[model samples]
Target: MTEIIDGNAVASQIRDDLTAAIETLADAGARPGLATVLMGDDPASQTYVNMKQRDCEEVGIESHHVDVDGDASPAELYDAIADLNEDPDVHGYIVQAPVPDHVDYREVIRRVDPIKDVDGFHPENVGRLVAGDARFRPCTPHGIQKLLETAGVEPEGKDVTIVGRSDIVGKPLANLLIQKAEDGNATVTVCHSRTDDLGAKTRSADIVVAAVGVPELIDGSMIGEGAVVIDVGVNRVDVSERRSEDSQTASDQSDTEKGYELVGDVEFESAKEKASAITPVPGGVGPMTRAMLLYNTVKAASLQEDVAVDLP
Candidate 1:
């Protein structure tokens, strides 16, 4: 029987664990605050920000939001970042990605105070992560480590193949798994689009993380027997197109009222058959990512407020 890792359960526990620390901070009159700065009106990004705000409210973290016009000048966005940096009420904040192309995302990240960079994308944070003295680990990668721990799938000496090289997931994850920590010490291979024979790499690993953003790129034949599979991609496919591709049944199509269905990089049914454990597209890594962001915000508040609190 294959174990289906429940990210919702794990994330809920993490939130519950943080409640004590949050209360401790509250007692000190330094309740954690997290802010989201959205530059454009991209529907997906807006939805994500909304969900994050709800998570903050659920955990007793004060939530704040700022919106910039889609056609706003880069300077206008920079002003918002500057204000967030100076706001004592905001212990941590993130400028939602996909800012207008005219705005250099890297420059925007650099402008954020490293101490309040809860997203862990700032150059200083990235450098600290690589140096093994990380102040903040990128949320997704850290969440992956937590999931592996909860699933009883230790990565200490296992081969981990991460199928993406984006800084957000791949680069940070590889750095993390190879570190000299309990969740670290894994032998990691980072694969990209140019990599030849991707299947061979995935098939040989004890754990495979599919994050390439391509829907159903990794299938059952590509996964090693008894290996752990973590799917991090959430892609929307038209129900009709998916049905035509034989990826969905008529009943499955009927369940989707939005004309589209969510899928991961790994083909779930096929990969589940060969895997010892696997995370589902909608219920796996997504919740963990949001949960970790809250974790970072709490940590940021603790550090800035000089309050020591236990973290999960």
Candidate 2:
């Protein structure tokens, strides 16, 4: 029997653990704060910020938001980051990705105070993570690690084929997994768009993580028997095939009215058959990302306020 990796349940447990930590902070007269700064009207970015705010509310973290016009000047963006940095109320915040092409995203990240970079994209944080002395682990990859632990799939001595080399997920995750730490010690292979013979690599791994942003790119034929499949890609694929293949799934998606439905890089229907365990798209990595952001915010508060509490 194949096990379905339930990221939501694990994230809920993490949130519950954080709730106790938050109460400890409250008792010490400190409240954790997380803020998000969005520079554009991109629908996806808006949705992500909203979800983060909601997660903060759920876990007793204060939420703050900042919005800038898509055409805002780079100076305006810099000033916003500065405001958040100087604001004593905002402990940590993120500048949502896809800031207007005219603005240098890297420059914005540089301007952010490393201590308040809850998203963990700062070069300082990234370097610390790669160096195995992490201030805060990147959220999505950390969430994936949590999922693997909950599923009882230890990465130690196991081959992990991660099918994306982006700085966000692939590079950082590989660095973390290959470290000499408890969550580390895995043999990791990072594959990208230019990688040769992708299927051959995935078929040889004990764990396959697909974050390439291509829907249904890794089918059952590409996966090894009993491999653990973690699909981190969330693509909006056309629903035509799904509508005809599985009416129930198509009906449930309901977003087909917009011409596309959400999907992961791996074809779930086929991959689950071969994998000992797998994570579904929306319920899997998504919830965990939000949960981890809250976790980071709480951590930032504890460090900044000098309040000592054991984190979950």
Candidate 3:
């Protein structure tokens, strides 16, 4: 029987484990706090920030938000980041992605204090990660590692084929996986759109991670039997034309809010058949990102406030 990796269940257990550390921080009079800075009104960005705030509330982390106009000057945004760095109340913070086109996003990352860069995008934190002495791992890649651990699928000595080269997910994950550490020691191959014969690489891998933004890119034939599959893409695909006449007899298709539905880079219907374990799109990697953010905030508080708390 194929096992479905349940990220929601795994994330819930992590939250439970974190509650004890949170209590410890509270006892020391140092409740962890996380802040997010937004520069635009992108719907997706707004939704993401709102979810983070909600997660912070549930996890006992004080949440703060700063909204900058989409047209704001780069200096204005830079000042906000600097203020967060000096604020005693905020242990960590993230500047939401897709800042104004005029702003140098990379510069924004460089300006953030490495110690408070909970997102781990700053060059200093990224450098530490590459050196195998990371102060803070980026949340998505870090969350993916935790998910693999929870599923009893260690990367040590395994062949991992990651299908993306973006700095956020692909590059960092590849670096971490190839390191000589607990979640490390894996042989990793990073592939991008330019990579030729992608299937040949995936078929040889013990684990396949699909992170490219394309929807339903990898199918069962590309995956070797008994391999673990992790889908990290979240794309909304238009399924209106594909709807079958018999799909939903009771519901009116016209009444649907949108014509699109969520999908991942891997074709789940086909990949699950040959995989030993796999994660679903909406409930899989999505929850782990938020969970790790909370985890990082707590850890940051422990280090900055000199509060001793046992973290898992």
Candidate 4:
């Protein structure tokens, strides 16, 4: 029987483990704090920020939020970042992506103090990651590593093919898996839209990570037998759209109240049949991403407050 990797269980364990570290910091009179800065009123972004705030509260991290008008000037957003940088209580913060078109997201990232950069998109952090001295690993990639560890799928000597080249997931993950650490040392192949013979590359690997934005791009045929599959894409497809036989069953389709359903880069049902272990779309990488963000916030607080706390 193939193992369905349970991300919720693993993430819950991580949250539970962090509670002690958070309490330790609290004893030192320095409770860890995290902040979210949303520039526009994007509904998805707002929902994500709200969930993050709730996670922080659950783990004893003080939560703060800053909102900028959708039409606000770039400088105004920067001012909010500047204020957060100066606030002692806010040990870490993230400026939610998809800022106004007029604002250069890169410039906004540059304006944030690297110490409080919980999202780990700053040039300095990226550089550190490439150099294998990462102070903050990007959340999704770190969560993937933790998931792999929990599933007993060691990447040390295995071949890993990551589908996608975006800086957020692909580039960083490739860099991480090839490093000299325990979670590193994997032979990594990065594929993109222009890559020739994508299936051949994926089929030859011992582990496949489908992070490309396209929904259900990789299927069972592309996955090697007994290989581990990690799906990182969460896409919403129209309920009326035709789905493959492996997509969803009639009973499972009842939850599409929003006229859409969530899917991943890999076609789950087909891929699960061939893989030794796989992560589900909604319960797999999503929770891990959020969990790692909280981990980074706690680390940021520990570094700033000089508080010694054992991190899980």
Model 4 lDDT per residue over 1-312, tens place: 899999999999999999999999989999999999999999999999999999998989999999999898998999999999999999999999889899999999999899999889999999999998998999999999999999998899999999999989999999999999999999999999999999999999999999999999999999999999999999998876755446867755674456688999999999999999999989999999999999999999999999988989
lDDT of model 1, residue 134 = 96
| lDDT score, candidate 4, position 311 | 89
lDDT string, candidate 3, 131-216, tens digits: 99888888889889998998899999999999999989999999999998988899999999999999999999999999999999
lDDT of each: 0.96, 0.91, 0.91, 0.94
TM-scores of all predicted structures: 0.97, 0.96, 0.96, 0.97
**1-312 in candidate 1: lDDT tens per residue?**
999999999999999999999999999999999999998899999999999999999999999999999898999999999999999999999999888889999999999999999999999999999999999999999999999999998899999999999999999999999999988999999999999999999999999999999999999999999999999999998776656646666668675567888999999999999999999989999999999999999999999999999999
lDDT of 2 by residue, 1-312 (tens): 889888889999999999988998888888888889999899999998888888888888989999998997999989999999998788899999988899988999999999999888999999999888999999999999999999999999999999998888999999999999888899999999999999999999999999999989999999999999999999987776666645656465567667777899999999999999999987998889888898899899999989998898
Give all candidate RMSDs, comma-separated: 1.5, 1.6, 1.6, 1.8
- Per model, how many backbone clashes are there? 0, 0, 0, 0
In candidate 2, stretches whose alpha carbon ends up further than 4 angstroms from where it belongs are 245-255
Measured with C-alpha atoms, the lDDT of residue 190 in candidate 2 is: 94
Q: What lDDT would candidate 4 get against the real structure?
A: 0.94
Runs of candidate 4 with Cα error greater than 4 angstroms are 243-253
Which candidate do you rate higher for lDDT, 1 or 2?
Answer: 1
Off by more than 4 A, model 1: 244-256
Give the Cα-based TM-score of candidate 3 against the true structure: 0.96
Error of 3 at 284 (Å): 0.5
lDDT of 3: 0.91
